[model samples]
Target: MTRDFDDDAPRRLQDAGGLINARRRDEAERIRARQRDDDERIYVVTTNLVIDAQEQLARRRRLDRIWRAGAALSWLSLLAAVIGTGIAWGTTGDLARFVVGYLICGGLFLMSLLTLVGVYFAGRNVSSLQRLEAHLASQQKALWQLKVKSNPDVDERGKLYREEVTTAIEYYQADSRKYRTIHNRHRRPRRLCGRCGQLKRIARNARDGQPDLCDGCYQGPDAICSICSRIRSCASRDEQGQPVCVTCYQRHRTGEPCARCGRTKAVNTRWPIGPVCVTCYTAVLRSPAECPRCGMVQPLIARDDDGAEVCGPCVGFAADYTCKQCGRAGNPHSRGRCAHCVLAERVNALLAGPDGTITPQLEPLAAALADAPSPFPAIQWLKESPNTKLLARLASEGHELSHELLDELPPNRNQRYIRRLLVHTGVLEERNEDLDRIPSWLEHELADKPTAHASLARPFLHWFLLRRARQRAAMRRHPACADRDLRRRVSVALDFLAWTDQRGLALADLAQEHIDDWIAGATSQRRYMIRYFLKWTTSRRLTRELTVPSIPSQEPQDLLDDDDRWRLLQRCLTDDALPPDVRAGGAITLLFGTSTERLCHLTPEHLKFDDEHAHLVLGRHPVLLPPRLAELLRQLAEQPQLRPQLSRAHPGPQWLFPGMVPGKPISTHGMTQKINRTASRSAPRATGRCPPSLLISPARSSPT
Candidate 1:
């Protein structure tokens, strides 16, 4: 029989057994010879090697098609369900025809619902396959190399290795209680990374049956850390034990108690005498002192045998302590320049104009920052503070360093900070921050408001509210409350105008009935605010005389009884365990009914110390304090440690109640909170009057 040969005859003959195909198959098998892994591609490609890469590519394309098909099936099912429901409900015909339509609809709906459920599973499969492909791509090349190079492989070494890799990938992808034990067991054989002291995995060596270094740490060699004098990776242990570069090591290290300063903090280095924290180390290194033992002007780092101070050189320490620029005996920070010089350089660089020189306007600020008591903080602030960028841009652009220019920028916290810094440094003249910020805040608040509302609000904010605020500010009083009230009034005014606009009414046409309606619907505080706006508008003759009923002030219903009041006063006098500020502040609140606002603003000047008695000058008259309360106030006033370090550095009236912010008294709200926590029940509950029991003497009023 003569067999007719077609075009596919040669390919079929080759498929049976061809030399070229056999050669390719041998190479592929050789590549995977040691790879005893139950890998799908390896299992499927026993005879056909030419199809491996092509098949892998085709699998990815096929997944894409499968995903698209699933999505199309989902849409088709949705369309069928919608059309079937519409046909079933909307069809109008004979009863038999309606029944037939309903049956067809039910069948279509059932089939579509089944199709949708299958599509949902198909979608999930596609998503899982895509995730597997991503994991395979990230690791396949390296894993193949590792598996091929694996020497004297075990019977199922490739299988175990592949399973572990897959588990690791899946474990990282999502944590599961099922995989947790396996994951932890795989991670149990951990060793300190040779590069960093951080713990890492130790893979098993197939030949030696011993642990080997993980792939990551094995790629790098350890180097000497110049600062710590340790053989470590170029990365040093930073804050929270995170690895950071060597240059930032000192700044980022987790701190310990320094032997010299006796403070728990980040130490710069281990000196001859003891561990020294960064601040103390920098202070000693920068400030040269005459060594009592060596009689040489150098940084006094250690005490001698006789307990006399000595320099690094006197103690035979090898580190260089000479500033190359000034020839001063100090540990230089960068480029052999002392910290002071480096700070000055950085400031000059930050404030330099196009001509590479500090402008006269910014000279004072530059001088102040450079001449800071501690240069390290100044350097750090310049390096990391966001405010530095604002200052740099202003300086580089040669903009005049004035209050108006700062006010022109957005009224953000950073802008306010820069303005305060400039004023503190005498680069800009001082102004009332609270009073000055209102107009800027108003500008931002009104930027998006309707023109009609803006017209009504601008004058109310500027002429009436700001004028009264300025008068208060002029009297050397803080206008924090006034500023808050002004902003509230303006916000309410705009809301009222918007309300009127929504109802197609104008402010000029706003009647007493409308004002009454507005007041009735508003909150108590808001009612008062709207009344304030109405009062302002009436005074300006912008609107007709409108009667906004005043919110009646409710009298106190929770005043302390006579016995309780006396007991609280006695506690204030005798309770030494109570915080001094709280005791003093609570006593004043109980006796004279002084508000928290008045208490926070009380300066040392407000206390009149006479021969026999002390008087707190609360208002126009000075109220005499009892002997014990007088003593408490005296102790608070005279103690230097009571004031913040920053407050002491500046020239200002010392607050009786000092706050954390320099040159500012404790905020009224803060004072109120503190008093409420400890002695709120002691407070006089009446609005304007003190308790009537104050007229009686403490000895006579004592409870029998």
Candidate 2:
């Protein structure tokens, strides 16, 4: 939009463009208005509308004066009438009675009537004047909206017009005065947060204008503790107005006095002052003794002269209370007695069970308690390790674990895990002492582990780690251990096998660094060994990120059916539309469906065969397979219909079924896909029989 300006468009011109113009237009307007400045003044323009109001104001003031004047005249007229009546009465009482009464009473009555009429008319005039003022104000606002601002040449006036109209609406329509203070205009009182109970302004500091909850709720992170299901810590920050262990912190802070010694303030508070320390708090909980009078199970206190462990208040008894048992004054009272003092009053019988005494026992169930370990676990080291910080931290976490798990590992503190790996190994050998270890152990040990059969623990340990501990220790001493990440991965693989789920562990602990290393690992020949470890360590989140593309469906492969796997190689190799990776994958999956993630580790050396026997050397030994799987492999070795023929490249990178890569083999993902496709294609006509890779209904009749 290019535009040449209209002649009157002075405001429309945006730039001067260095063009100079000499003009004297201002003088003409001033010259014309100079002669009748007063007549053409702003007041003159609107004078006609309010001229009558100004006149009426004056007339009303004059009328007020006339009212006073007439009132004075009326008083004077009544006084004269009274004076004339008195004079005539004295001369002739009976003869001038009617004239005296009429003149005196009538004059006063007429004066009052005239004054009332004048006041009514004056009120009417005031009402009319206010109505006229309001009408004039409305008209003034309308005129202001239509009026153009200060430039005579400018035709377009959007900016000025809008501003004036907005002003008219706000100024004349609003009841608020122009000079109102901000506090008076919009301030609201502060309110309490319903959730957290912190006080905040009702309208201010709101998120999207929503009302704020109290500090306990709104001020902290709103997350629940993974262990307790109590709102322990929020995912977000406290300063950012999210939940931050508010309930937990508050519960800790609002401490009551020592139940054992009621006089002492018992708990920690928001202020640095007040209450017993944590030691005293713990003591109060453990020392349970009853106050017979109050029938309250309170902390134990020393017995007094009366043989009663009375609470602080009860000790000063001076009132003439009846002795509960004897009904006498001051009989020697023991516990459960009143001030009159009878000893076995039974005011509060002990709440203990029939066979009552403190019995300390370990909480969780263990497989066997009889077997003592070859070495004592680090019992002393743990007790001395941490008093509060780490011990409290671990105990708070460990206490909820099942017996089998807690016993398997020691919760002992002070011993860095790597320092005494053997001790842990020994203790795991005997999981019967879950409680013998300090309580702090439970909180830390019990979290985030898979369930295990108690009966199997003793044997599993003898097989899995203890028997191999020496081997592992020897391996750790070796040099040139290139893949530390992969080694760490091996631990998870073992963990995956040992455990069933990733329930208790924090997702943050299992990071991407670990996953990438695990996928890159190529050391393990036995894929299941590492696979189990991966499953153990893999959190639900990491599981999604990890894409070994296992049998696409969550079904298990049928060990009974080996022919379907052979069919897969036929379909993939014959189908020209199929990708090389897919065909390679299809062929490899037939051997091990779970080895989907470790296909690259496979090598030609794994394929060993003869007319009598054929085996894929997996897990450092020959895994002899059925004739069908063997036949499929024999066909693949000779076949290259869809790919370039190898020029004497001995595929012996140790791959059982090598693909395009010279040293590297096809990956597990390809293997998984091949297995899945084969399973789905063959599964339709099988009636109840299905591939393990497919989901199956758990039959109510008890599926094996």
Candidate 3:
């Protein structure tokens, strides 16, 4: 029984040990469950905190985007408003439209400016929110760290938790400080105006103190001048003991009595000796001087040949001799004969007998001179004049005198004067041709055709002639070239009309086929000349719709090669004997490739000179003139006699190459002829090679 008891005790002890171990395990399990609950609670809290922080950050980012969008929209609106303003300014023509456009644009611009200010403040707010979000994120991180800490001691755990809380609080405080900084950065101070009671930005005056009123409501001090009663900062006391502005002060100072006249009028005229009134100054200029010849005092004076001052009447008496016949003061002449007497003597010699009696051959001229008011010009034409002899000879032959017959005579100034005299004396009648009187060639050509044909073509013929007459009248100064062109155009029209009339085709029924047929029959060189007539007929609606074939462009056959150009340039540069007009014209053509027509029209006005260089307005831009060409043009400008005679109807300055008539440029044909003569003389000499085509071609056909 004792041995069984010992073994059972050991077993019971082992069982007791096992039971203690199980109890300890059960306690540990309960503690672990509690710890897990705490951990889960901390994790849930941390997660919630993180989610809230993320949401706030997301909200801040959205706010930031909104601010950025607002800023972009404000800038875009500003740009659009600016563009609209520019468009309005440029396109609006009337005052009302301009005002409306400007108002609209201004309103848009102001709104955009206000929107931009709002966007800036919104952006600052977003930054503050972002900082707050950062603070929240920092708190979340600290909470997470606290949750993961494994400290067993309560004090240590509490210390860790307190440190995290303190850190979060510090972060929160820092974020708040940052937010305040951002807010303050954008904030502006405002104050209420004392006078207007309106909130406005503070504006301090350094001269005085800050104004209690806004700029709109402020009315400070009055600086009214006592003399002018005008508000001016420049007001001060004048010497007259009155408050005055600078303008009034100056007027008062100048209003003092003049030293010479003692008048209160403002002294305008000042002399080196003293101030003089305008009236006194004028009196000084008009002071009387004693005449040396007549011993008379006169206001106006003149210098005599001996350098003696003389009165106006005395000077005129001394300078001019009295004509015994007309009792007029005239220039001195030979044998005590005045200008009129000398001219009259020459006229009497031409038209009178040896006994000084008027001859029958010149009775009409003598009668006209007797009837004239002033016969000096008529008498002047008889002195050593060829037109006088021609007229005498015509009168001696008993020829029927008319303007047409006189026009057949050679053109001369004296001849024109004699014709005017004859017309005035009724010896010659002016010729006025009837409109039906066509050219002899056309008249004879139409006589052979049917009367109906002539009648049908008469209107067209009249039209052509009338058009030519109009052109001639417009360009009568350029008669030679104008007549030549008119002849060519009229001849073409006549021939075309004759051809169509012979074919029995009415002008209104005319077609392109008839025109093409005429063109085919015409000379190949002149086939295109009919295009002008066709255009005229079409414009007059005398024919049906017609499309004249275009004249084919011909390749230039006279382009100057390099060697030819060099030789031509050398001729222009080295040849001193060449006429200046030719040399200048050739240089201009070779350098600028200008046509003769354009060159003829060039005036001194087109040549511009500065301190540095000379320029020629050739085309759209000015061409810098070469030194040689500039010197030649200067010489040309100095020679006024080189200009052609201008008509009495249209008198102007002479051209570089004046035409036969006054006030007209040189004829293109005449220039071409002159250039041809020059080119012929200056043809290049070669060494065993053919002359260049450029040198061989006539100047009229040569390329510029």
Q: Whose TM-score is greatest here?
A: 1
Worst 10 residues of 3 by lDDT: 683-692
- The segments of candidate 2 whose C-alpha lies over 4 angstroms from its true place after superposition are 1-40, 47-105, 115-130, 136-704
- State TM-scores per candidate: 0.52, 0.18, 0.35
Cα TM-score of candidate 3: 0.35
What's the lDDT of the predicted structure labeled candidate 3? 0.60
C-alpha RMSD (angstroms) for model 1: 33.4
Off by more than 4 A, model 3: 1-486, 501-517, 536-547, 610-612, 619-621, 640-651, 681-704
Among all windows of ten consecutive residues in candidate 1, which has the lowest summed lDDT? 695-704
Model 2: per-residue lDDT, tens digit, 1-704?
77765854664453342232212345666776774474445445555545655566566666667677777777776777777777777888753665756665677758766875877686674644456556656655544433432243345566566666565556545554532433433454457764445555443345766656534344444466433467554443344454446454444433466533455443532111224555654443334456676665444333466666643334543333234464432222243243222111110111111333211211110101111111012222222434323323433343332334433444443332311221222222322121123223322432543344222332333344333444554564221122223333334444543433343343335545554444455344333334433343243233433334232223333343445545554665556565444454444443344234344454445578887988876566677766655665555555543321222212223444453322234434344335445544421212122333532222223211
Model 3, range 2-55, lDDT digits (tens) per residue? 455576888899999999999999999999999988987977787787777777
Better of 2 and 3 by TM-score: 3
Give the per-residue Cα lDDT of candidate 3 at 137: 65
Ranking by lDDT: 1, 3, 2
For each candidate, the alpha-carbon lDDT, in order, equals 0.70, 0.42, 0.60
Q: Could you arrange the candidates by TM-score from highest to lowest?
A: 1, 3, 2
